[model samples]
Target: MKKLYSILTTALFCMLFWIIFVLQDINLLKLDSQEVITGIIVSLIVAYFTHRSFIKEDPFWMLNFKRLGSLIAFIPIYAYELYKANWDVAKRALSPKLNINPGIVKIETEVESEYGLAMLANCITLTPGTITMDIVEEEGKNYMYIHWIDVAATEIKEASNTIKGAFEPWVRRIFK
Candidate 1:
């Protein structure tokens, strides 16, 4: 049963990719008989090869609609943050005095899973002003060492809120 579910999930994702990229149809229309047959064949083959790898310790956890919804919502928020970070970095670069309080600060994160922690680290690193320097686990709690161009607050809670407050909860939802 688990293998069947894994295969189905893999095939479904592959078919969706085929429809979007090859068919170029968001509505999934305008697909001819040959294209449909080809997509099904390709998806099935890919699923057969990849199904075992897809089913981890938790088979259906990642298939939750709520997590998908959170991911979709996070996209726009990330874009806005990216835009603001770019402007901030540009201003700092072009400034006359170049006032920058550069230091690495340790901030605690509620995210426990390695995947979730990695995602958070990548998101912070991708942003312009802050870079995730290291991730440490102490007493089963995860902490991120972040290199900030300007240190606004030295307190850990304040630093976490300032840097990852916007996306941390969303990431927890998506990866929990």
Candidate 2:
């Protein structure tokens, strides 16, 4: 059963990857037959090695509509944060004197699942002005050590709230 689920998951992932690759032009109506065939070949090769890693305890978890919806919703929020952070970083860069109060701050995350914690760390790293230095599990709680370009607050709760605004909630919905 596990092997069957892995195989199916690999096939689905391959198909999705092919679709995205072929639709890069934003024209789904026209697809080249040669490209489609090549995509399938490449996807199959990738799936062969990666399928096992993708298999979750719940084989049908990927089919959850609520999780998909959460992922979709997260895109816009992430984009907004990315844009805002980029602008802030650019402004700081262009200034004569660097106004950054650089420091490492520890922030507590309620995300218990490994996947959720990883996603949260990645989201923080992707945003400008912050990089996730490390994730430490202490006393059954996950704490992320983040290097912030400007350390606004040092307190754990305040730092966590400021750094993880909107991201934690969306990640919880998608991965928890």
For all predicted structures, in order, the TM-scores are 0.77, 0.84
Best lDDT among the predictions, by candidate number: 2
lDDT of each: 0.87, 0.88
Weakest 10 consecutive residues of candidate 1 by summed lDDT: 22-31
Model 2, residue 120: displacement in angstroms?
Answer: 1.2
What is candidate 1's lDDT per residue for 22-126, written digit by digit as tens?
Answer: 655444566678878988999989998998775554567677999989999999999998999999999999999897999999899999877788899999999
Off by over 4 Å in 1: 24-35, 48-58
User: What would you estimate as the lDDT of candidate 1?
Assistant: 0.87
Clashes of 1: 0
Q: Write candidate 2's Cα lDDT for 55-124 as tens digits.
A: 6566667579999999998999999999999999999999999999999999999998878898999999
Question: Which lDDT value does model 2 have at 2?
Answer: 77
